[model samples]
Target: MSRTYVKVIPTVALLLIAGFSVSAWLVYSTSLGTDYSKYTFPLWTIPEGSHMYTQLRVGDLNGDGLDDVVVTGDYSLEAVFQNRTGGFENRTQILPSGSWDGFVLEDLNGDGSLDICALNATHDGTYLVTLSNSGTGAFAVASQYLLGPIRHVFPYRSHGSDVPDVGVYLLGDHNHIVLLHNNGSGHLTPDVYLSLTARNILDVLAADLDGDNQDEIITVQDNGNLTVWSKSASSRQFSNVSRYLDTVQAKRSAWLVIADMNGDGIQDVGLASNIGASRGVLVFLSGDSINVEQPIIERYYDYTWLGALASDLDSDTDTDIVLCTQQTVLVMENSQSGQIGGEIKFTGFITPHSPSVIALAGHPSPALIVLAEHRGWYDLNLIDLVVFWREERGILP
Candidate 1:
């Protein structure tokens, strides 16, 4: 398949003018700066016929030892781009994995290769399909099961399991959380399922909080109440549900990402809500298992709508947070002492839907991939992470 290439024009300059002041109402102190005097960003083109490339997952899918990406977009469009010498190349088209709106890629079979798990939307009925990697850039449905309507799908290593298993959060009045354990083959067996008292549940996340070496699932109800569920060792079920965060009223459109934000080695939580005009993002730093005494911190910005991703953006050995408005992408750096500050801005546009940080095969740092839908283009731009050396600036254009 031929890809669509575009001329990349970068306007970011290296200057220390206090800050760019993209958001005039930010409440945090920021001196975060970027030196872009050395180079231009590299663009990885998508097929011209592709609809909005909605979801992306990166891995060595074809066993070529090169990084490849699996993407799904409008009209159930799906394909995989193999990393080649120039950019990405795909000789043939990849069929959709049952046109599942949500999916994940992981080594589900304990085999040493990546596999694809896909599912249709919640409104499209209930089915979870597994496509096993045949080690030849092709996939075949190894197994499938009727999972009902699920809003989220993720693979995780449960408390005592060596291999990662699948967990899904059911949608609608189902109010159930289901787990499927991988049986060493590319198949999933029904392990545990639990029903909640409430309905309209949306998203779920798993992380090892409290540093007990056991992970707990974090979720939000449609009513804006944040809660967490833990696996009871004695009962062998996901029980012991408790309220985690007393969040704002505008939460139905909100989302949360987990990381060790406080440098505590324990995973903390951050919530990005599209509801509030004044409150930017709510961060609950890692604290006690039951409650962190003073956890909530509002890293203020002026944007009415926001979405966020938390990763080590600056290569500071600690994960930082990235937030994007309709027109700009902001990076919040984290010091080794867990201090979150020095926010900087990048001169680009990326929607908050799915802002991805991808570590390319050859680069020393990760690249930020975001779709500039506002620019009225079908392609996306990559912000390459380059190290700033004083001597290299003179040689690089």
Candidate 2:
């Protein structure tokens, strides 16, 4: 070969190598350009055996800037765990007798101080709504409301089965809901019981479903029915605005949550159905009447009985769904495009019976608070509050 020909061949080889190098560099840059910082994981599990039946985070619970947790357990025992330097310290305990079903923390009395609403089920099959607050590390009950006798009050009895058994170990019973309203006198009014029908009501939540300023009540019946009751603007009375039955042919109990899933300003409903085959339904409301139009149904593999469902995961502006099965937890994203995304599996964790999960929005980024019973205990065992974010380019900062 001639010298010029050899030089031309070498030049071509260099050009080919340069082209490949540039292509690889471009591909690597594009791959690293993604914003995975939003998926980072930072978890803080509450002290073991706190028996946190319900957990709510509210700011200035002890006149401090940090958010404090209000937890409730059996025997109407309500405790306020103050958010100290890094961990929680028991602050106060209130009303230790009737077993509690659900709880809420708010300034119900409009007193600038935070108060609590406890839904207590008495031993003799009666329901009591207790309102209390913490003063100098002790609880002081302000008022009590005797919510009429709950229809099926026995524990562990099937829905609509009035067995009338008084065994404390029985767990399947209809629990009453507790809703708090402030009387604006530094004292919370009695909890208003909102039971539409005599059927077993599973979960109840309060949110502004419509664009109205007042908050509405969203209840999920054990028979897989979603009911939205709007609070009257003037009278403060609850009126049944709309109801939606599971279009799917299945009899199931549902755990429901209300949030703006589609970022449409209006709150949408997320229902986790424990039907024959476990599945979840996301219903988006349109207009101001709780008119649910878009229904997205997602069925999980295996016997995935969904216990608790929460939204706003991944902090993507659009809401996501977290489903707690007996063994694993699945996180489903709401793409807002009418199509559901794949799942983020959280394994190696036990979701106790009646597990409750909520997104903690009080932090810089959102975290998840999961309330579950211990491996052997019947009461609440562990409170795992985890904050997650994503990192890109192998750097979290």
Candidate 3:
């Protein structure tokens, strides 16, 4: 497969001055300082042939121990396997052109191979489609269950089960969470409601935030509040709910990422606020208990962050923050105290959405992959799978 490599081009830098003059009571401390233009970002774009791409999932699909990509779109389901040259092969269409939306990659059948659980929206209704992988990059339809319109499907292990279940945000009428439990037979059974009252569900993340042995389901709502649902020992279901980010500082929450931002053992929550006057990213330093009142706040005056991911960008054992805007990619180094230190800006991404991280087989650092749509030659519409193989200074081949 052919790939497009564009040389590093310097983009116009907009210096964000610290301290907001809007509110005097609000102590405006800037973690991301005024230094915007420092290093050139190294990246390459691969034309995966647009299908109105919606989501991308990474895993070892071909059993090569390399992270392969499975992409879902409005009219296509495709897989791009990583080759030995630290690149990808031509994308293979996993299913015929269809209305595919949110999907996840996991071992559904317990055959040790990763399977696909995808949501397909059709003219009739939305359906949960399960595709069984043959451990050789080949997939076939295992089963399909008619479901309501869903936003996304994620891997969740419910009730201490060995099999990984699938959870999704069931939208329309009343928004809530519904789980399609894997019956250990490679088939998903629906109608399991985790939270019937979850309103305006924007994103869902599964992690053990409170040091409990059970995994907690964290959901970000459109109202800029976070709800954490933990499994009840007596009920055997996720019934215990705790709400966070219900502060005046948080408004119109764009997205949330969970990781040990500091060297602290507990998992911290990083949130990106997209709207309101104080729009920026903040890190919640979690403790043995849920801390909802206070967060280590950081604000960018002019830039609007759409999405963010927490990862150790320099392999320094401390988690760094990577926020995506329409124009540039922002990297904030994490101090040991869960505060931002230095920042790097990578420009030249058009309409970038859902930034992800994947470590190739022979690469020393993980690569940042983003789904971007831009116009190609002859003014044709193109969706490019843009990959950044570098950090602040380190570059990958």
Candidate 4:
């Protein structure tokens, strides 16, 4: 890098004094092509430096037989894009402006219309807000209640409601889980806070691990071990006994993704690890938990693999993998027999942190949405989220 300075000013100094001069500078970067040719488009973008700490949630919120997307990265700039045929259109903004942490789309009200439940922020305290869907892409303020800061928000059914209850992970060093109960009218009420671990947990996945009808809470610690807590639907509290996979560093990496790679009905788990002086991924096979100490698949790339998503990237009908690296996206084919093929890396991303795999309405194939924060940390003044799609394999069946 070289330091150079050019001086040019006052050519129109008298014009500036006469209020008739202007000076401005602009820069732009050209987009690149991915490894595979697919249907890719930019749905929407916000002001630069907006933190997409939470991934965009895609589903049918309006009940119009199409998938819509809701993004809450820019606090007071929450926007919902309705799946208009094969393309997405800006339907409306969830919040005009403000500091909102995260949000979830669930039927907070039993009105058969899916509502927006968001974590609103304020100077005093963060709040839980319920915005009812008046129609497709239309949301009205249902209720807003104050509480502590929320890192992650998941929906669960408690208090005997037809809809699921709100499960939140508090933002703190301590590992505490709070369940906010609904007062039957779509309003969230304060409920019990349960302590799950001594230290902080990375992420929470709400799913039914066993074949049982009840839902279970799965949390992964930094060390890569997992703890499964059975939830009582009626009581709305964790069961006294919990299941644990106390394997010795089964997940040697910081990232973890759960999916059934072998076409099994049960959901298996994948824990990423950087062991043997290289990057690796361990599989905690769901049924009998196969190869506990050994990893079913392992691979290394040039940069850091921040996150991984389990999806059928190709039309093979088997679950493939999408790895979100610091600079590119890698697609690995799953042999469906515990083997992974070589990596097919895709470019056109700058400091990409994570990627979300979603099926848009009208589009037959699932698409990958990656939010990039320029080259390093998130800058509130620059923004870019690219979408990659395929036409052959429509979204998962």
Clashing pairs in 1: 100-119
Residue-wise C-alpha lDDT for candidate 2, range 274-316, written one tens digit per residue: 5565444334443244445435433434433446555554556
Q: What's each prediction's TM-score?
A: 0.72, 0.62, 0.76, 0.70
lDDT of each: 0.53, 0.44, 0.60, 0.53
TM-score of 3: 0.76
Better of 3 and 4 by TM-score: 3
Q: Identify the superior model by lDDT, candidate 3 or candidate 4.
A: 3
The residue-by-residue lDDT of candidate 4 on 1-397, one tens digit each, is 1111212111211101111111111111112253321233443455565555544555677777655666655555345453533445564666776676677777777777778888877787677778888766678888877767666778865433577778787766545777777776677776867776535566675665565655566667756556666666566467524434434453444545656655566666665544333344434445335324444444334344556666655555666666654444455566666556543434433423223221111122244333333322433333334444443224422
Alpha-carbon deviation at 50 in model 3, angstroms: 10
Which predicted model would earn the best lDDT?
Answer: 3
Candidate 2 at 99: error in angstroms? 1.9
Q: Let me know the TM-score candidate 1 reaches against the reference structure.
A: 0.72
For residue 206, model 2's alpha carbon misses the true position, in angstroms, by 2.7
